[model samples]
Target: MDWPFSRRGLFQGAAVATGLAMASRGTAAPFDRLRQKNHPGWVIGHLTGAQAVAETLLAEGTGCVFGIPGAQENELWDELKARNVHYQLVTHEYSAACMADGYARATGTTGVLCVVPGPGVTNALTGLGEALLDSIPVVAIVGDVGNGEKARPFQVHSLNQVDLLKPVCKAVYSVCDVKQIPNAIRQAFQAATCGEPGPTAVVIPYNLLIEMADFRCPPLAEAGVPFDDAAFAQAVALLGDKRLRVGVYAGLGCMDFSGSLTAVAELLQAPVATSVSGKGAISDCHPLGVGWGYGPHASEVAEIAFAREKLHPHKSGIDVLLAVGVKFSEVSTGYYGNPRPKHVIHVDVNANNLGKAMPADVCVHADVGLFLGKLLTCGDTLRRPTDGHLLAKIRQAKADHEAKLKAIPAAKCGVDPLALVAALRRGLPEDAMLFTDVTASEHLAAESFRVTQPRTYFNPVDNQSMGWSIPAALGAQQAACGRTVAAMIGDGCFLMSAMELSTAAREGLPVKVFVLDDHAYHYMQMLQKAAYKRTTATELGRIDYRAFAQAVGVAYQEILVQDHLDAGIRSAVCHTGPVLVRVLTDYGDRKIRWIEAVRDRYAKELTPAQKARFASRIGYRTLSLKPEKSD
Candidate 1:
């Protein structure tokens, strides 16, 4: 579609359609004229406290505030509910933050979240970090005690709130002046969504929310424009080198700039891949499209295939890596094992991450979607796809992985990871939104499943936090009305937010949760098995997941093998309410020896500096393990 806010169309429409007809005879400031002629007797409401801030927040399009409501935030919650803004009561503050983060990631807007001061805020740090790293805009409105003895005691109880978040947020402001609430809301929105979007925090005093006052919202024009074009153009040229066999990697940012990415990719015809977080950024079936590669598991295959000749359809081979709206974390580049063919071009809204790990050959700091639009104009030409011979090699490399997946055998209690993923892929409804929690199961699903659309596949990749899938799916299901939301989580991930099933049941959200019951942190267990040659605390006693779901008043069933998966999913979907399908699987011995050999060959003999660099890579911490080997 047309750019959401086309400057030319906006300028033309304003000038031609309403310029003369709406113009005043004499020159006067628009705000001044509005305050006098059109807005006569329009008294500006003075919000005295926190409840008033909630009222103003409600006025500004926030439908719900996700949080673990407590004594400190009760007044604000009461007022928010009174204003008809729903409260997404969650099990933990982090899960609540994650729910909002997931919603914002999918919707490209500031997700509103509320939390009590101290413990509550601290609990949400993980989610906040995830949102920051992924460039997902979310507004964290925390209720802090006012400047008094209680505030000092609060400080002692809490890690310095703003200090704790400084590294992970766009900005943090304490709301003191009652009148500043509206501006604070606007600033929080701007901070969360501006160039290199991320979460922002606005601390409001706990006692102030109950204070009475009138609230007035600022006009839309006064909300400040997002980005500047001149600055954006400079950023676009950073990756505009013609000699560079540019591999355009996109993420969630491309979903917002859909046409811009298509325009730019069509012009360059470069091989494109989407990060898992940006799954729907481009059509996965397209010739130019390469699948998600942001972790060691797949990155090893991608690195080898990309480095060798004629791997992808665009065989030109990535002489220059141009990542747009994509976070180039260590995982994004295979723990830095994926050697750059030439220059690496990194474009993002966050300046902090521009050159953090895999420093870009050319770093362009600007709004991802905006810069993408400008890049389309800057590079306008349809070029041929790169080296053709490489395509066959990539196919062979991927086929090798597929063969390994097929060899995995099912265990008595725990199912094969590949079989579980295949079952979910085939069993779920066509339009279902699939969400994978952090575990070996997610890696299995990521490798085997094909994501047809972007937002339909959800995972907290930037932070890779555990326990995010179920709550995130709940939030997404609320956003996707009648459509199905299938959350594939591990046993641990389910425990983290399983209690929130009460909230799901209360809200009547129709989401199907497929709990991959491995009975431990499978990812960690895999690593331990690979490195330490055994397992310890990684294992846990079995709990009846069916009883747990029934206790929460939702439907539940057990699926022990691939044959039973389809029926279990169909039953869950037919229930018209929340359903939890627990799929029991063994830690079946299915080792990915090929991957281990690849990494061991290059990584085992690395120099100290190279090793240190590798350690600092994203997702590298978990590189000690390889998949189990059935053969």
Candidate 2:
């Protein structure tokens, strides 16, 4: 029999995975490996495709797989469990994708999600889009309908999955033969983690999953960050200017290099700011850390610290902005209001993102880790004596900001959103994983939340996918056992993903999900009331969340008054299983500064006629409302 394994391919793939490592991780040696080539990488095995799939996943260091198995993928799902590879069954396909995303973000490793074809692919698209835009590494293993020699048209759950996924995935691979399954899956992992990471899809026909074939799947080396020597030379030369007032704007790309980032910041004597997704890349407690964003749309502390006039008598706010690993997305930049300083040194792993948001004096296409690492090599040239004045300004701004945050209290009706967020910040573990959804409180949390480590805080900023936090928290909890994981979800967002809470309860993931119960889509209400002078269709049904929690087989806690805040958090944290915590929230007369800044920038872009129309509508609506008849 002619061997189906390729000799050329075996030599080309992998640094290699140790058998001892696989054993330690509880994965049994591959199901049926009858013969192996001279090279250990090539495991020529007479096994079903499902066995091949499970073996590859274990080798790739995937701790858990999140998805709902269906008819098309049942065989593969069974194989995964047979090998002792942990798999969590989610309630919805969308939640599966979100969970995978959460796992990837929290653990800084690739997340895997498996689903059947057609509806499964469609249902998971939104989560994939979120992952893609947020630069998350997720591998979506989708099972396609049979396309063997006798393949027929119009098969059940059969659609052009590859085309459907292309919009949301970084790359998509369609496997034809059973022998190709291992390489296809391995390549998916490589694609998912390479450079600017995002979701990658590997489509395997269900027929192939059950077919027996000889396999030669050798895992490939994980992708490494790019380093351009000449670009580093150019960047170093720019930083060598001792007279330049430098400021650092870091992003998610700088996550793995936080230590290097901190070193470079101290050397440059620069204040550091981050994008929303980039929060926690530097410890917010760090003296040099000014908080997220560095313009009018940013934190007041960041705005003040970056203001040249505030720090110096005559110099500009930031003479040179060292922006790394962050894109100026509309949400993060507040309609691109983030500063475009005189000399912008924008560096990123993804070349496409560089120089597109803000014009750059020097654009460096390199991984943030590699770039920061190179900077440390010539630390002396970039080193500057610490400026007492700059440090004093940042310290004062932070102190005042903290004082302001501490002084705010909940309004009469319910807990103030920021007050709740601040309480959680104080009560939760310093190293806890916090995920926030798209809501008014998200902005409030961004302003007041204190994060001490990289990848500790996450938000659906660019995608603005409501209800993302619930599943995301559970997903992260699955990967991060023993660490606390929490989600601050709005009442409206809670409704969108309320079913997913049951998945956590079933899987026993201890994720404290807090529902900011305002009895309405208050985030939308705020936006609409400002634009239309009256809210429409923003109200949500008042839910008896305690009862809902009982139905879902989880512990329930509610923080109605300000007095119960600490006790409520403690109860949830101490609970053994998943807990749903509800905080009655009031956004009355509270301001989300990010929203205000975005609205202001948007208003400036409105034509005079457009403004007049809005004004006319507001006037008409205000005049049309009749006074209530008092008895």
Candidate 3:
């Protein structure tokens, strides 16, 4: 046993030497020698295990990471900080996921989120579901217990975390080996941004994160494939067929696509209809921009009908519909059946969406901006609205629709949802963001508010899930500091996520929640009355919302009249932290126009008297706002 110069000593010496070699610059280890150059981007790294994962994130150009680094995954946090990457500590895991989604929605790039186990995964589920439905690109790197050693049953740190997330994620990767982390991250990114676009999950075990690194992965940034040029040419050629009446349907994807949106409008002299998400994608005042995506009132109906005729197939007054980046959904399209237009040409980044149900005669799985730009530059057959009579018909349709939307008179105790939305729009800044939940409250907001900027309106309309408004607004507030963030939730949706206001308060995020207190889901009531002709399970029990707000230590307000609306909004905006404004409403009886429109459109043969009665009840009326007390 003299000096014990054994194999163990030699192994220890080699480990130290390897560590030193890794620390030295320009020293190529076996893993480094095997690293692939010219793979995707100029940025490359030789990393393995948890360090490799961190290096992969850096390679992907992720400037910021929104998450709380828990005890189990502090190593990842340390590595991120070491690389000078910014980390935002969101109030909760759900907020972290939503914050990333909002960032991606605003920036048009994939966002990154990190979370711990069990509850963390559950908390993030809602936002991830929303991203999946909306075709947003987001990546969630969740931490798990490495090596699967659990002292107790159902422990949070189990390796089965990837399996837990598989149902909701676009793709799930359980990295078991230290060397596989880099490629796993790259695949996660690809799954998120490629094809239909959605969220992907990469689960890293805590034990694995601490393992020694063998290599680093380089960033996989590269120019996306060129837009389908042949499709562009075909679209241009189809538009040139003067035999067809071509109309352009625009979506949010076209907001910054000045070249393409403008060129297509000018070339085809076709009016443009935008989805709610596409509000302001094209200038509302633009001559070619007809109106919004679907009909909420007469204005929308008239605009859509006018647009349909101009783009109908067979060039028979309306022959072709060039829909761009519009994810035609039920609410956006008034729940009426989406009639396939003649020669339907759909161009969207999500290829899976192009031929969905309503088959597209010309499906261009390309970016709207890129494809439109090329078509505008190469195609020369598009023209202005040369037919004066046709333009007038379109104008008349819009005017009639607006008049219908204006007809619903508000009862003495009821508030006009549209007017409230208009007030919010008027008082808010151009760049201010508004978050809203599904239900009648959102419908009114969409109908009345006119957004002209990106990230100006944030509605969780994708999954059509309730209780998303409050947390989503908190996420937005965290992501966009110093900007006004407000969530407009119905009495029903408000109650679901209202408890999270405590988190908002603790985080010092100044998010205002406006509760439309109508004592029920008014939209459901309206639908029941129209369809089933009865109200059931739509009423809500009364509670002191102001008291609830006060208990949460948030500024509280209860407004019952139009005169108090502006003051309340201004006061909330000036508050330092969270505020809850309960605007008592009686929209319970207000009629939803889309439902009425559908009824009238599909009414069967009727007698002279029946026809007269239907026509009289078909028109819209404005609901007048009045002062009232909470009885």
Highest lDDT: give the candidate number.
2
Worst 10 residues of 2 by lDDT: 20-29
Compose the digit string of candidate 1's lDDT tens values, residues 491-529: 877777788888788889888888877767777776655
Q: What is the lDDT, from 0 to 100, of the residue 468 in candidate 3?
A: 75
Q: Which candidate tops TM-score?
A: 2
Q: What's the candidate order when arranged by decreasing TM-score?
A: 2, 1, 3
How much RMSD separates candidate 3 from the native structure?
7.9
Q: What lDDT tens digits, residue by residue, belong to model 2 across residues 351-461? A: 899889889888899988878888998977888898787888888998998898788875788788888888899889999999999988887888789888999999987
State each model's CA lDDT, in order.
0.68, 0.86, 0.70
- Backbone clash total for model 2 is 1
216: Cα error in model 1, Å: 4.3
lDDT (Cα) of model 2: 0.86
lDDT of model 1 at position 415: 68
- Model 1 has an lDDT value of 0.68
Residues 239-341 of candidate 3 have per-residue lDDT tens digits of 7887777767676667667456866776776767776666667655455555565343423532454444434433224468888887676556665444556
Report the number of clashing residue pairs per model.
Answer: 26, 1, 30
TM-score of 3: 0.79
- Candidate 3's C-alpha runs over 4 A off are 1-64, 67-71, 74-92, 148-159, 221-223, 255-259, 294-317, 385-411, 529-536, 541-543, 551-553, 574-577, 595-631
